[model samples]
Target: MRQQLRRQAGAHSDHLQDVLAVQERELKRRFEAAHEDRLRAERHKFQAELAVVMGELKGVRDAITARADLDRAAHHAQEMWVACQGLKQAIRTGQLGAASWQQQLKPLRDEVAAIRQVAGEANRFVESVLTSLPEEVLERGVYTEDALRERFCKVERLCKRVNMIDDEGGSLFKYALSYLQSLLVVDAFERLPGKEQRDESISPKLNTYEIIARARYCVDKDDLLQAVRYMSLLQGEPRLVASDWVRDTRLMLEARQAADALLAHAAATGLQAL
Candidate 1:
């Protein structure tokens, strides 16, 4: 009986040891899984922090770059102004003359053009700067609004002089007149605050007047081609129709069109040449 009791106790001890071993294995697996999940969470947190830092760094870099660009642009503007002053002084001292000044004009014009390109606003800022300059400073060979006007007058006088000398100054006169007219147009457009203010400014009316003047000049020169071009420019503006010059020019153009159509029909029908 004692042996039977010892055997039963040994069996129970072995079964209890087996059960404890299975529980220990399961607890170790659960601990390892929890540790792995904690490590993954820590990695994700670090990656998120890194992404935020990179974004901030990029923003700071962009701001620094933009500031640098602005500084460079400002420096270029100052240099252009200095160059302009030097050129004006040279012209004043008789270093440049009408015979050779046009060649020298290219460099200064390029400098102004460079400013427009770099500033990204085109001619707006440059024209505004020119407008702010004194008339006397502008008159001394600078291409300001007043200066260009003066130049145009001089060119007109030169044309008359050449005509008196029995020389053909038609091309030169037309070129100078066209340049001044274009400058006036650009100046007027720049004067407006926005695209919507185009009609509000006196620019359109001024443009019509300029076109009419060009047409009259063309008529005086007997330049039918240029007159037609000037007339076409006024055709877009219906408001100028009340002007006698506009009315006359339109009538002339209509008469020319009718004549052209008749000539075309005559040629198509093999009629004799006029």
Candidate 2:
């Protein structure tokens, strides 16, 4: 009986020892898992920090690039202005030699191209001041065919020198020239007494019908000033004055003095003739 009791006590002691060993092993596994989880969290935090640093660096790089571009544009604009001035001075002095013409002209060409790229109101003003219109041409009014042609040539030369053909002012100047030419032609015909005396006129083939037709053509082309001038010359003919085109053109020139003056003169002349 004593031996049996001792054996039973030893078995119970062995079972308790096994249970303690299993619990210890479970605790060790949990500790190792916790350590791994902490390492992963730390790695994730390091990646996020790296991304923020890269974003800041990229922003700095972009800002530097933008500033560099601005500086370059300013420098180019300054260089172009200086070159244009030199060319203008050379032209005035007549130092543009045939052999060195291209060399001397290079600067102006470069400047014009640069200015065109940066063409704003300020740049346009600078160009106009640099290539100022000729005093002699502006002073004289172009009346005759020869004078008009000569004036046009002078204006065209100025436009080419200044690279101004595409500008608003340039377009207006060209239109003015056309208007003047049409005015001169109509004036020549009006000076003649009648169709029978057409032989005395320069444009002998242009009768009253042709004159009125030309005026209508000018109106169609949106050359109102020229159209008005021609219509003013046609005021001698009552039928033309009553025409639909004439009425429309008169409406267009409703508040203008030029149109009123022509109508007044024609009425006075007709009264005198009667």
Candidate 3:
């Protein structure tokens, strides 16, 4: 009985040792699985954070590009505005005359048109860029330089035409002297007989009046110099043949010279060149 009892106690001890070994293995497996799960959770958290940061970075880059484009467009518009203002000032000052004003129209029109086109393009670009944003944010006024230049050019051309006509009329008076000279050379008084000249002196007087009439006609219809030349001929006739001839000649010469001087000054100034 004593031997059997000892054997049973040894068996029970072996069984308990086996059960403890199995429990130890199961505990180790559970611990390893828990650690792997924790590692996977940490990796997933890091990946999610990295994706969010990349999205934020892309948004920042896009905003920067949009803002840069807007700045460049605005700068160009400002430059165009300045150019238009300068053109306007030049027109107002009369520094640009009719011919010059007309000539400038082509370039001014082109520039203004180009500016408008560019502004339109820029507006479209801004609109597209801000399509997601509100319209009020991109609102701006449009400028039309071409219209203003057109009006200025028309006025300048009209002024130049008027000036041209005035210059032509003023210069015509210079021809009167030439007319008088021609009359003197022709000796128009010889048209009457010698006896008639001695009688009432009507021949000389008639000759003078004829020359004056001819000169007046030439000056009115043809040229001033032609008239003046004829007038001078009548005035310069031999003093022995006519009375009061010297006085009349001096007066006509003086008047012709004054007109010539006025015309010369106008020509030199380029006012009559147009």
Candidate 4:
């Protein structure tokens, strides 16, 4: 009986040990699964944060590109405006030159009229561009100093070409006078108090003889040395004092005295002879 009891107790102890082993294995498996789930959650969170960061970077890049495009457009519009203004000024100067020559030569009027027509077309084109440009561009003062200077240089070159052509066509004096007159007109017109008055009245009347004479008088008074220089260029190596005499110091003196005498005679008798 005693031996049987001892055997039963040992068997019970062995069964309890086996049950504890099984419980330990199940606990280890559950802990491993929880650790894996936590690691997976952390990885998913990292990927989501990276995606958000990339999206923000893309937005910033797009904004930068948009700003750059706006700047370029504004710059282009300002350049166009400056070019148009310069072209208008050149056309006005050309018209003045033509008018001055017309008083002395009829054919010059036709040339000037053609230039005026072309200028009108250019003006219309510029006006269209101005109208089409965004108001923001003008408000921002998009024209750079370099752009303005370049346009001015281009217009000046055109004026120079016109002057050269006029000189070649046998009207150097008239063209020079026209150039001086145009400068004065532009200055005065720009200095006017009101934009409307300048644009409507002063700007359009820049091609008149009175205007030329006024400009010449102003220039002469301002710089006598420059006036003398210009006059010397115009006279260009005096060749003859009169129909009868070749040019010399003595002949020049005699010619001056004769001119004074003729002026006096004309004043006295209101008569002149060629």
Highest lDDT: give the candidate number: 1
Q: Evaluate model 3: give its lDDT.
A: 0.42
Per-model lDDT: 0.45, 0.44, 0.42, 0.39
Question: How do these models rank on TM-score, best leading?
Answer: 1, 2, 3, 4
Question: Candidate 2 — what's its lDDT?
Answer: 0.44
Comparing candidate 1 with candidate 4, which one achieves the higher TM-score?
A: 1
Rank the candidate models, highest lDDT first.
Answer: 1, 2, 3, 4
Runs with alpha carbons beyond 4 Å of true place in candidate 1: 1-17, 96-274
List model 4 lDDT by residue over 242-262, tens digit each: 111111112223322332432
After superposition on all CA atoms, what RMSD does each candidate show versus the true structure? 20.7, 21.0, 24.7, 24.5
Clash count per candidate = 0, 0, 21, 0
The worst-scoring run of ten residues by lDDT in candidate 3 lies at 135-144
- Candidate 3, residue 91: how far the Cα is off, in Å: 6.4
Candidate 2 residue lDDT tens string, 83-158: 4443334332222443532232222333333434543455555445334423321232112222222333333223
**Candidate 2 lowest-lDDT run of ten:** 136-145
TM per candidate: 0.33, 0.31, 0.29, 0.28
- TM-score, candidate number 1: 0.33
Give the Cα RMSD of candidate 4.
24.5
Candidate 4 segments whose C-alpha is farther than 4 A from its true place: 1-32, 95-274
